[model samples]
Target: MQTIGLPGTAAPHARKPGLWGWLLLAPMVLWLLLFVVVPTGILAVYSFCQRDDLGRVVFSFTWDNYVRVFDPIYLNILGRSVAYAGLTTIICVAVGYPVGWYIARRPAGLRNLLLLLVMIPFWTSFLIRTYAWIAILKNEGLLNGLLLSAGAITAPLELLYTPVAVVIGLVYAYLPFMILPVYGSAEKVDNALVEAAHDLGAGPVRAFSEVIIPLTLPGIAAGVLLVFVPAIGMFAITDLMGGARVPMIGNVIQNQFFKARNWPFGAALGVVFTLMFVFTYLAVQWHGRRSQR
Candidate 1:
């Protein structure tokens, strides 16, 4: 029997979107230009200019602020911030990956509930949550009391006002971001591909390394950028938990703005910080595309 092609069987040709699409996107373009683009332009202009003692901008262009930014003290702080963010990203990936995988494999009805639980903390103010950490980590706080009762320590352990607490706060705050993207990728993974690898005599470790890891890499890259970048710029947790003892880059930029009354220096730091983020984003994208290929 001869058969005719149906409309449903015809291949659709892709066409360039018309001007209507650009018209629809105009509002978003204008918003971005007005808010993000304009502010960044102003900041870039300020970065090259000198500031007066009263913190007013002077139009005279100078590179003194940029030179000061490379001084050892600020460089050391920037290095420390990178280290902290690196550690946070590592921890978040290690912890979030398994949880995301498990959640993604769960029944559809349960996955939403689990995700909601993860997001519930965001309903409260982040500052309030950070403050609560103070009460929990203090000398006479719940941790110390529990340790004392358990005879783990003869005296109250100094848990608060330390680098550990700062790390804890950062990981706690950003973990959900790492998980959500990984879960999204994991959910889309094909079960048959894993089964095929196993059937081909691949062991668990080999199967993961050869098949699963490659597929979920997009999520891992997204999660790493999500957790690492913001962690580097976080100052509040460092201040509240680390007692402002060891300053991060974020603290220095903040000091320049408010305490040091050096707007030019702050603007320079802001520009540099933003550039770092852009580099990180590009690096992540490059890695993701390479892994996919």
Candidate 2:
């Protein structure tokens, strides 16, 4: 008969952390407490509080801010933000997958070179790069000038300060996030598995659908989270390219603090926004696990 160890008994390999371990972990614990935990606590407290006439957060508790969050006007803005983010995610997946696959299949040296090119844009300031897009998209800008010179069109197109420009800026900014993860996953896929599928009378589409996609799904999931979350909350691109004509959730939150001078309301918006993101990430993780099972 086999005997099981008692629940409270330590296994032979089990050992307690020593002084070195505690010392090493201390910095990380302190960092989290200072930056994450403390700020979240302050935000949570402010969310439940009220603001005075001067727009200062008062300690008096109230649910008015949260109640206002569900108002129709704000709900519409939230819905619009979701729509924009969803569209951006779809575009990123469509454009990035092929780029990732191509880069992953390249010779090792060429692969590194292509990846360097992808990352090269990051060397410059993000604000400066965004401003560059403004230059290109403006009515009398490079795109319009070149088109006119080539006789492609009779007149300049209205490219800047539109929904189209916002989407373009978003895709440009987040494409690298999607590509890097997809490339990482695609790089690890065995060529032999693809060859085996072909041997079994599978066509390119069938093999890719059954084998390649399934294998690279983890990366796809990561890319979706990366691109979707930030895109939803992005204010800079929308403000610069979309001309702030359409207000997103991020813009609304920014307005609460700066324009409206309602810090408590802004804090409430931020708390709710954070919760929504948490819920979304958990849902995605749950779905991924369920699919795997």
Candidate 3:
């Protein structure tokens, strides 16, 4: 009689994807090639070319566009963008982690309701939501009125068109991105393992630190990836809230393409931005693998 493999022994080898599987993947692969790869190729080609006085792409090779990206003014903007994104990521983790954990630990019915509430903001148009923040942060807006009524201050604070307003908009928009991923990870943690740690004389803090955090790390990394990358490149939030006072790299890229009519420089900036995304992804993946090891 043939014996079944034990848990420690290797199981039967799985079959590779066949013709039907390839057929299923064909649409997605084609879509990626058309939308992602082709566009990136075009952008890279443009980045190496020049622009004429008439704002036309000149099919000639030059490294000036990339060199210009390293100019002091642009470098400062890049630094500022990184700083803002880093701050937003930190705030999201601090606030979202607890909320996600709480919701995940709740009763089934309540958990669904809380998740719905967290996701409701996405139902509305992003532009409309950002405009709503302008009304709240303006001098004569809801926030100032509330502060005045509460006798918090005599004069209205200049909250709008500032770094603080920009940060608030960023945090408000991206907090849900952080929360959902964390909730997904936190929900899967086996309660028995936590209990076992406690039974072994681990304190609440110790158990949570040593067990819960590690278990939820993948979600946190995913959340950071989701939040940090887009946050760095977001132009709308910074524009409406910051009123041109705080310009991120996204704003620079947009202006290069539209306002300045400098496609080559814009493409260079875009290529750099894409590289940053790749680096962030690889770093997150590396960290996750290290934690697993």
Candidate 4:
């Protein structure tokens, strides 16, 4: 006997993108091809190429660019960058998760207001915001001024242009990224789940550990991806706040491209950064899938 396909089911599942669907997707596909795909391809090609005396990218292939990327100095910078980013991610998660959870659990009106305050930073240019932090953290800035007035210290604490300052800037900038995604995720979790766990004799900590956290893992993963990767390559924060004392891979890549005029090496570094990005995404995805099972 022949089986009949249901109207609202098998047909829609089997349907392929028709002309309109392709048409609708044309702009996005074009954007990805032109911007993301093309630039990545160019970077990959240049990574295997060489630069001439004039710093022009030469088409001839060699592995020297990649070899140089593995140099001890560059390796050290890469490791430091990862460490700084990791610390920043950890700090943001610790701070942001609680704030996000609190905000998500708040009443609708207050939640909107809190979320608005959290997002207020984005209203201004990020560069401007970074410079604002520069003002706040400088030796004679508001923080030290307050501390001095409060008799907290004898002199300025030298907060700016230090690793501590860099971490502060990173956390300040990326904390919102963590909070927003987490808020989105936590908002979806049912309050009923918590009560249900309590009814099942689970304490607050146990309920949070076994029930709420699992539900919110997606947001945490998203927050990690958003915070960690960009933190690693935050050149402006390091340059402005770190005083070049902490040269991250981002700064190195920037110098290679613009200051040192080493396009091939820069492109090689870009390729490595891209691979790091891909690996990070893959790792997060794998963990997310494994957790689901």
Model 1 over residues 84-137: C-alpha lDDT tens digits? 999999999999999999999999889999989989999999999999999899
TM-score of each: 0.93, 0.93, 0.95, 0.95
Error of 1 at 60 (Å): 0.7
Model 4, residue pairs in steric clash: none
The residue-by-residue lDDT of candidate 3 on 1-293, one tens digit each, is 01334444343435567899889999999999999999999999999999999899999999999999999989999999999999999999999999999999999999999999999999999999999999999999999999999999899999999999999999999999999999999999889989999999999999999989998998899999999999999999999999987779999999999999999999999999999899989989998888776
Query: Model 2 clash pairs?
Result: none
Against the hidden true structure, what lDDT does model 1 obtain? 0.91
Window of ten residues with lowest summed lDDT in model 2: 1-10
lDDT of 4: 0.93
lDDT of 4 by residue, 1-293 (tens): 01244577466766888999999999999999999999999999988999889899889989999999999999999999999999999999999999999999999999999999999989999989989998998988999899999999998998899999999999999999999999999998889989999999999999999998998999999999999999998999999889988799999999998989899899999999989999999999999989877
Model 4: residues >4 Å from true position, as ranges? 1-14
User: How far does residue 69 in candidate 3 sit from its true spot (Å)?
Assistant: 0.8
The total of clashing pairs for model 1 equals: 0
Cα shift from native, residue 140, model 1 (Å): 0.6
After superposition on all C-alphas, the RMSD of every candidate to the true structure, in Å, is 4.8, 4.6, 3.7, 4.2
Overall local distance difference test of candidate 2: 0.92
For each of the candidates, give the backbone clash count.
0, 0, 0, 0
> Which residue window of length 10 is worst by lDDT in model 3?
1-10
- The residue-by-residue lDDT of candidate 2 on 11-125, one tens digit each, is 6545677898789999999999999999999999999898888988899989999999989999899899989999999999999999998999999999999999999999999
Error of 4 at 207 (Å): 0.8
TM-score of model 2 relative to the true fold? Answer: 0.93
